[model samples]
Target chain A: MKAPCTVALDRTPLYDLHIASGAKMVPFAGYHMPVQFAAGVLKEHLHTRRQAGLFDVSHMGQLRLIGVNAAAALEALVPGDIQGLVPGAMRYTQFTGPSGGILDDLIVTKAQDHLYLVVNADRKAADLAHLRANLPRDIAVEPMEDRALIALQGPAAARVLERHAGGAAGLKFMSSAAMPVMGFACIVSRCGYTGEDGFEISVAGQDAPALAAALLDEAEVAPIGLGARDSLRLEAGLCLYGHDIDTTTSPVEAGLAWSIGKRRRAEGGFPGDAVIRRQIAQGVTRRRVGLRPDGRAPAREGTPIADKDGRNAGAVTSGGFAPTLGAPISMGYVRAELASIDTPLDLMVRGKAMAARVAAMPFTPARYHRG
Target chain B: MSETKFTEDHEWIRVDGDIATIGITDYAQEQLGDIVFVELPQTGDTIDQGGDVAIVESVKAASDIHAPVSGTVETVNDALVDEPGKANEDPEGDGWFFTVTLSDPAELDDLMDADTYKAFVAKL
Candidate 1:
């Protein structure tokens, strides 16, 4: 097993609370974040599906793109329909490199005056640098270091949050509002990484612990760690940055073409637009697909995949035992010809070929509250 | 008379005459968190000392169970295949992975006693 790098680890605002809650802290993206709590990963994952699970996501980068032309300026960097976003509306987009590879995927929410953005923890510094370098000086990139984010996710998330912030319950999915939560003004976005009806609340760093404690006090809420967070997203078939989608993968190949608005596709204004447009017009050679291994033995990341004739097809990028499905699940890039649903494939595990098939994602259906 | 011995790798062995029952220590199960699956050695398979005998997969990762001494597989606890969590619940008892006929009884002398193993774990 690879040893965990523990040098110069950073702590989030809720670090003390996590320690008090018996969290198994591990080095994740340079932060000492909780991997699992006393209840373990399995129980926490189930609780999030049934009730509510509170996750401290302060490690993610939160920033504001200030200026009137912020949306148009950002559109030049990503394929998402940024300028089309109305106030309180959010769009998920990726920062594409000059070669059409994804620099990072982020959530861009149009606030009243500026565009609020949340990026991956590991890519925060690089994203900040990219935004600073690419975006014109007229658009100011303000990194919000004094804020902390908490995600209250699950079927009962809205109910648990409704008690604290009444206005938050009214926000539709992918919408955001500055609501008073626990006596502090917070940006409550009706969205979450988990495929459930949930909210991600951005609050002052100092008030984070208190706010998290208040929410955890609810009967339907439990403090969750990163372990459950991974399984929940995997079951949801969400792409994990640096794993399922990375610098070598294109948005079209990764099955994220829906995020590229129609206007952006026709207008052709973004880094690597030529390559992306070509790939969009014609299909990609390799495509991302979901794999359901036939047995209990999980075909983990980097597991080689073979075709029916025992020829090398592709490799698994992200995989593990899905607690919800009670079977091993995986997501990997395969030859375009074999990316069709129900395509029988073989996952090579420790020199043995395990039976697996390409299945439609998300291994579980998303339960987002559309209204 | 039967005597229990422990290896540095956290496996437990109970020797009765020439037959020895092998399983993981409670400490090993606790470290692995939840066991989702178990891959045990087949009956009649010959395993050398310290060879891979079984595999215990937790929600996090998989760990190999090595033989404490060279022996031929006699019987395995097939119950673990259906309920791998049994290893977490009763690691040293019903969680036994398999039993093997001892090929070298002298290898038992190198194993640590229960008290000595407990002291070894404490230092970790």
Candidate 2:
């Protein structure tokens, strides 16, 4: 989630820790979050790919949905098959509007008695309101406001985490378990936004500082900030809530058909099931694809995407210099016909055309711990 | 002999006779974080003081690099094209954006000197 430009920015539980570490804090999702630590974005970005980078993601809305019908209640909102989610497993999904447009992408996990949801901080209020109004009164959507989330991500994430909680090393991707770390109780999940083998640990707000400190104490771990996080996710080909997917962008157009479960696809129960099914059967007009801009110049968001002949094709949704690739990369929607890999295009930046081509995402391969 | 001045827009200029070399302030580069690309005005282009002339892109956002004084573009630092991070490494040195033949040397009178720029940055 991106920060709002308001003066009343809130602080995370680890605010003092951030200040002590010489982190450069900026307003993010109504909070004064760190955009970069002393290591800087470039080093932080590279460190996450090569080793472990710790991230503070406490601003997101962590909610617990309870009652016997919680799964069915959530299934009515998203296209994913929530009922099929086994305990300790996580599924990536997004909330859809009536027209099949995305509201916000989130992760859903099922536990012993409730469904765990992690939504964007900016849309938490509306999401809660939507749930309260739509779900049966018996079902409860309780916000976990007292918790702080910390992510330890990268190739060395498992080893770093294992130093504290030995069992964490055994958790596979999209799996979760309650672990006790340094006398603190926390829920650790084998998932992260950076497309790395990592874990997102949710613990009490007061325990965050110590937990974060312990993780950073690892030889391979560094405290990364939002700047590197954005670049990392972009290189991972993940969708950012407000930028990549929004109220007007459908899941199909956003290239998220895999998120829509087969059971839910055949049985239309979700909000935008009809439109989503239609787009799935007959491809959408536009598709989200990775772009490789030729030359050293970087093309940013809103740059016009044009064909070789300078005909308007689409617009860039996200673009930046990938520290891992050492080149400019972008992702945006283009005409489905032109979304094929290797399709030559140009990013019209500053009234001048920069050479670009549609390439296969993720710019880098996803190294999730599926085992 | 040359005089260096700074604009409220966070740009620094070194004036030697009618020629002025322009770049963003060290504070400006620090605030913008790591710069990835720089778009400079072509040589021979006439620009007004405070006119938008170049673009410096970081991983987080793109910031406008404005012309601090009225002048015609003489030459751009082509090296910034390949190594934009120089703006963060040596913002006032090798990161210099372009040189211009000042169309109005009188504009320099209103710009802040080194000490004044330092004080102004302290307040920001």
Residue A298, candidate 2: alpha-carbon lDDT: 79
Summarize candidate 2's per-residue lDDT along A163-280 as a digit string, tens digits: 8887999999998988897779989999998988999999999999999998888889999999999999999999998888899899999999998888989997988888999999
DockQ of 2: 0.57
Question: Over the stretch B30-56, how does candidate 2's per-residue lDDT look in tens digits?
Answer: 888888888899999999987789988
Q: In model 1 chain A, where is the ten-residue run with the lowest total lDDT? A: A1-10
* Clash pairs (backbone) in predicted model 2: A3-A28, A3-A29
Regions more than 4 Å wrong, model 2: A1-7
- Model 1, residue A17: distance off in Å is 0.3
TM-score of each model, paired residue for residue: 0.98, 0.95
Worst 10 residues of 1 chain B by lDDT: B28-37
**In model 2, what is the error at residue A361, expressed in angstroms?**
0.9
- Number of backbone-clashing residue pairs for each candidate, in the order shown: 0, 2
Model 1 has a DockQ score of 0.59
Looking at model 1, the pairs that clash are none
